[model samples]
Target: MIDIVYILNQIDGVLYFPILIIVMAVAGLYFTLKTRGVQIRLFVESLRILFEPSGDESSVSSLQAMLVSTASRVGTGNIIGVSTAICLGGPGAVFWMWLMCIIGASSAFIESTLAQIFKRMDNDGNFYGGPAYYIEQGLKKPKIAALFCICLIATYALGFNLLCSYNLQSTFMDYSFYNPATTPMIIGAILAIITGYCLLGGGKRIIKVTNTIVPLMGVSYVIVSLIVILVNYYNIPAMFALIFQNAFDFQSIFAGFAGSCIVYGIKRGLFSNEAGVGSAPNASASATVSHPAKQGLVQTLSVYIDTLLLCTATALMCLSTGVARNAAVSGAPYVQSAIGSVFGTAGPIFITVAMVLFAFTTLLGNLYYVDNALIYLNRKNKPSKRFMNIFYVAAAFIVFIGAIIPMDAAWAMADITMGLMTLINLPACVSLGRIAVDCLKDYEKQKKEGKDPIFDATDIDIDTKMLDTWY
Candidate 1:
């Protein structure tokens, strides 16, 4: 019997190992150089712009948009994903994850800036855009844009959401009363019901939920990680040494590049921060900023927050506890075990609660992107209210289905779909990247003149006729 799930994993591995990694690295480096390290040079500026008011109650603020994106970025990937990386790829994977964030932030800025540059507005005074809008408007390729939108819908609505559901349910396996079959179905029903309520209420409801949950959950998780670090202060120095030592083992890296620490770190890091993968731009395009670069910079900071802060917090909590790292304890169990080493019975309970919050917010956040993609696909003849309601019910059923699937199968499905999305998005970003670069220059020139930067599409050579929001 040929196991289909095993084939999926193998295919995902081949897709990512050298080809995806090389393209992602080159694209990140290209953006980093083109913007002259915008991620670092404008770090403080990004922070300043993050809290700026939207100036319209109907429009999302920079902070709210960031929270919405962060809700998706900082999900189970920050918890179970990090644990899985360390377990399979060694502690050194943490170092590579950090490295990817630094490079990938620049890509995040470029894609998001382009998203805002070409965003669209509906009659209801709401904003929506992503790779699809930018590709069609900027690249003048509506067909490719449609393809990208289809991939986006599949990646977020079906693939990633399912993985999140599975990861959330996996946390309960340690409890004494857990039944592998019944517990997953029960938890899935509860999660699906809650998610369906939010989805049917539409985009505003989704934003409200993520905005409230992201900040509270992030702060609480960071505080808990701090406690874990303090308890294992004695082992901190050794942990750093181990991470670096394993990170730079060239011989091991060459021998098994696909299964190496670098590969796993990059894979999970991209999953967590989602910088170059092109997901954040959906939320970035929603913000009502005076300048596109402002939201771009804000999104760059979001990458740091997701990976550098939240993901690192998870990695350190696990490593600092000196927990055993191997396939047998990967995913949620590994994180639970690591924390349990420090807090005993209370640790697993805390992780379960955290997973619920993280995965739930992620589910909503992912659906938010799905809404954007659906709108783009249906721009010709807008989807009916009844159609959207049916879609919501169908989406909830997918969540239930996700909870019952095998873990490897769920993750492989997400990885392959996400990889496809990245392949489509990266090229479009590179082609339209010059516009983003020009936007940054315009922004900086205004800053130098001691004035607030406001975008004028005419300032750049791009066709402004298609930029509905800018006018």
Candidate 2:
């Protein structure tokens, strides 16, 4: 298990920093320039359209789509993933993480816009599109499209579900009364039961559940962290200073983690926010909207919400309590320790309960994306609802199996699969980014004319008959 983790980390280290990080960073910069920094100029426009009703009666609203992606993005990554970054990379990692999200928002805008542009409607009248859809439609490479579908299912649906399930189990194991031998299986079974029920109900129930739970869970964590921060108000300035100082001088302050500060920081940041990772595009494509750029703008904001707000809150809450300095500390235990210091034993209790809800929601979001991937794989262009049902049950058992593994092994599997996914996905989003830029320009042009922006496939010179949603 240790060897597997080491090898995965080495591969991830190479791809993440020197390769995908640079690729995504350059793509982000290119898109930012092309779109004239739409993430900033249109930040308000993003929020404005969030509540606008999805004119299509069958599909979910834009806000619900955002929440669905957030449901996936805002899980253990915001809490456990942030804590791990701080522990492995030091407080300085926070700075790099925040930078990643801010820049990656542009990349998010690009990919999600492409998702909207290439979206297709099935015979059953449901909308579906993502990196896979765009890869086939724009790049005209069915093989690459199939490759991306396999990667998405492996990473987002299978890999993340297992990794997070292990963490959720680990949190429960921290207590004495829990049977170390049997407890993990028990937790896994319970999660499987709860999640299976929703999976059987189909996509809308999954979206409905996330929309209801994402806001409430996210706000609840923030409210508690705010209370913790308020009590440690004086330490806030010192914490901020430490973050900035160490970000640059981590080598002088912490002996071994010199270069790792930026690498681990960027890695965790990307993992947490998932801005350019192509995961959110699946959920972003699910929304019924007036224009593709509107969903793009909304998704751009989702990155900020994941890293800037939820992730920052977790970091401050951990660092402010002074628990994050311990190198051995990581994952939910770190966040739990920091909050426990302020709120008594309620810390573990709070996070354990929170993890159950947060991780469960993440699993549901994963299954939703998996459903889309399966659809994309269908050669017949017909509903694979029965096959999806079989996969869902198989995944529930996999979750139980994953819960039994050591946390290190779980993370190792997730990182390796996720690395391969980014390698395949970043190129598509980058090559096709110009489409997103043009879409944004068109939307702004219409808005300036005092008209509600509506996307017309014909206007873009793309094949109109291919895109059922736009027509």
Candidate 3:
């Protein structure tokens, strides 16, 4: 009768506290220095390339790829996750979240740039890659690559998707019509059926669905947040002051650093933006950009959009209302109540709708990464139609199971799996950091020459034999 969830939580605590945080911070700083702050220097360039055409109608465009990744990054974590951080760690957590995004964007650039550099083109002329691709191709370690793929599948397809489903369903707990016993199953079934339909259609369908829904939902959510913020305009300045003051409270930092604002902020920030967690690169590699660094830069922009824009909107909307931050008012309920206080009954309704949209798109985006990892694990042999059908059914079944699980268990599972992914990806990125830096230099060198940058594998010192698409 060992409590597995408790053990998972304990392990997650140990992995994240000093170990993952230190490693992630160091990797982010290292990449920032190596690339001379590509995330900042190429900020405008990132926006410029985002709308660049794919050159082929069938290929994924840079904007499409970004939406795919952003779909996953801006899910329940943006709402429920932000609320939880502030509830437990105080408003100061918001400051740490922003700080993490600034540094973590560099790590995002390196991993995504490396993904594009070592990407593989399938027989159908589609591109695919991620940490597993670079780990095997760049580091020349098949075993490690396999390990990373397994972790990626577990994190996204199983753990995170489950949490998304649970969080989405939890939003309904405040409704009068919701029956605790039957409602979860009903909601889960509906979600699973919709998700299965998209998954069965394959990656293109998922891409199309996310590409359309992500933008609409993102803009709508932000508009609502803005309305809430403007309604409480008078409290905005004090909210900012509280966030900064708590962010730098040295006494709290030294007294109980483990439970301090910094830990929760960084943890929630990583979950929200997924900067260095190695997830976004799967989407980054899908884009048909002229230079690998172009897609890299776009993914860096995605990190900013997720944390700086979406997460900030949620944080400000919740805090500016002066909602009570306590264990009793954390997660989805906290968000619903925070917005509810402002808009009355309409507030909770809007939050529920927003959560459904965010979490649904997140489910699709997370599974898209799972598809890429499966491709890598299958050794580039496209999974047979029969196998894919079975896979889709299994994925849908997991969504259903996620709905009935306890919230704490679901979050714990996701955090542990995601932490493992970061641990595996960051080290590999550090080891292969040189290639990404060289690619950036080559890109900048071309930009300075007044030439549109196009990547040539031979332009750098990496083994061209490993680059399937960039030859």
Candidate 4:
């Protein structure tokens, strides 16, 4: 197992340098150009949509959808992920991360728009959508769509749930100085119970829980980061210079640890916001909104908050205290060190609370991802509740085992799975680009003519029958 993980890590190191970086960044760049800065133009309108009370109470509120997206986005990537990027990529990696977020906003807009456009309502009148639905319904390719759903479920079940739960559990254990041997079992049991309850309640329940949690956690962490930044205000300039120098200075990257740093930074950034990896659209699809473009606008703003706001805050906090520059800086310890510099012994305690919340949100989000994919695979709610129970138990078991593995090994597996998921979705976005553009155009024309830009299921040619069943 260790050897396999080592090999995967080596592969990730080699591939992310140019491959993942170029693919994600270029996709974002292309989408941004294609949309002509639609992300920025629609930002305020999306916020309005998010805050307004929804007419349909059975479906998820817009705020709930945003939180679900946030639940997934604001995990390990904000804390350890940022520290890792800065440590390996130097300070400049943050700039690249920011660039990806900027361009990634467009990618989020396009993908989520497509998801909303092609979503299917199950027999139970609940909505479901993702890469699978878009590929099958919009592209007229069910075989490919089914394959995508299968891969996605595997990624969530076999990859994310285990890693996230383990990380959450470990961070807690570390904070309490508990015995590592016994903690995994306790963590696994608690996660199993919590996730089991949420999954049984369906997507609506997940969204409800996430909406309440994401904002509370996000605001608390941001406030804490602000305090750290103010305390270390003097170190901010040097941190910025180091980041800029390492990112553009090709010479620095080639100098032994420099290249690793660049690769690490970009990898974590991609992992953090999940720009083009296509996961956010799964949550975006279930929203009971008028036009696909509306949800798309909402999703683009989500990427900004995740990468630009949350992830950047974590990066600056670490850099300002020189946590990443030290050889001893690693794991959650790096973040604790940065915060501890200001708060003394209380720093690690704050981070422990933050990480637990972060990991908990991520675990809940991952379970939802798996549940939606299962719905797509089954296409009906009456399939087999028993089967889902088995899947959850198995996932919990894996989480226990995963907590015991070395951090690097666990993280490598996650990257490989995430990268593969991104590769599958990017092409679909490019091919279905016109459909998204048409939806946006139609929406704009209606808005201009003093009409609501609501997308009528009958008007669009796809399959109204599939969508009507949802409402």
Q: How much does candidate 4 score in TM-score? A: 0.89
The runs of at least 3 residues in candidate 2 whose Cα sits more than 4 Å from the true structure, single-residue gaps closed, are: 178-182, 196-214, 250-259, 380-386, 461-466, 469-471
Over the stretch 1-471, how does candidate 4's per-residue lDDT look in tens digits?
368777977876656756777787778778887888888877787787777555788887667787688678878778877876666556787887887777778888899988888777766676777888788766778887777777777667767766676566655644565776777677767766666565556456655765576668789888889899988899988878877877788766677542556567667777888877888898888787777888888887788888889888888888888754643455577777788888888887878767766776677667778777787778634348788777776776666666666677777777877887887788889888877877787788888999767786555444554443323
Question: In angstroms, how far off is 67's CA in candidate 1?
Answer: 1.4
Models ranked on TM-score: 1, 3, 2, 4
**Per-candidate local distance difference test:** 0.90, 0.81, 0.88, 0.75
Which lDDT tens digits does candidate 1 get at residues 1-471? 999899999999998977899989999999999999999998999999998998998789999888778878988999999998999888999999999999999999999999899888777888878888888888889999999889888988899989999999999989999998699999999989888887888457665765676678779889989899899999999999999999999899889988889999999999889887889998888899999999999999899998999999999998999987899888999889888888899999989988988888888778878877887889734688999899989889989989999988998898888999999999899999999999999999999999999989999777778788665
Which pairs of residues have clashing backbones in candidate 2?
none
lDDT of 2 by residue, 1-471 (tens): 367666765766566657766776787788788889888889999889988998776778889889878777888888888888888778888998988788889888988889988887767776678888888888889899899889888986678888888888878756877897899999888877767776777456665765676678789999999889888888999999989988888556456542466776787888888877788888888788889999999998889999989999999988887764555667877888889888998878988878877887788777777777777788726466787678878888778777888776787677767777777777888788777777888898999999999888777756665565676
In terms of lDDT, model 1 sits at 0.90
Supply the global lDDT for candidate 4: 0.75
TM for every model, in the order presented, reads 0.95, 0.92, 0.95, 0.89
Better model by lDDT: candidate 2 vs candidate 4: 2
Candidates in order: C-alpha RMSD to true structure:
2.0, 2.8, 2.1, 3.4
**Where is model 4 more than 4 Å wrong at Cα?**
169-214, 254-261, 324-328, 379-382, 456-471
Top candidate when judged by lDDT against the true structure: 1
Q: Per-residue lDDT of 167-278 in model 3, one digit per residue for the tens?
A: 9999998889999899999999999988888788845765576567667877988998898899999999999999999999989876887667898899999999999899
**Which 10 successive residues of model 2 have the least lDDT summed?**
250-259
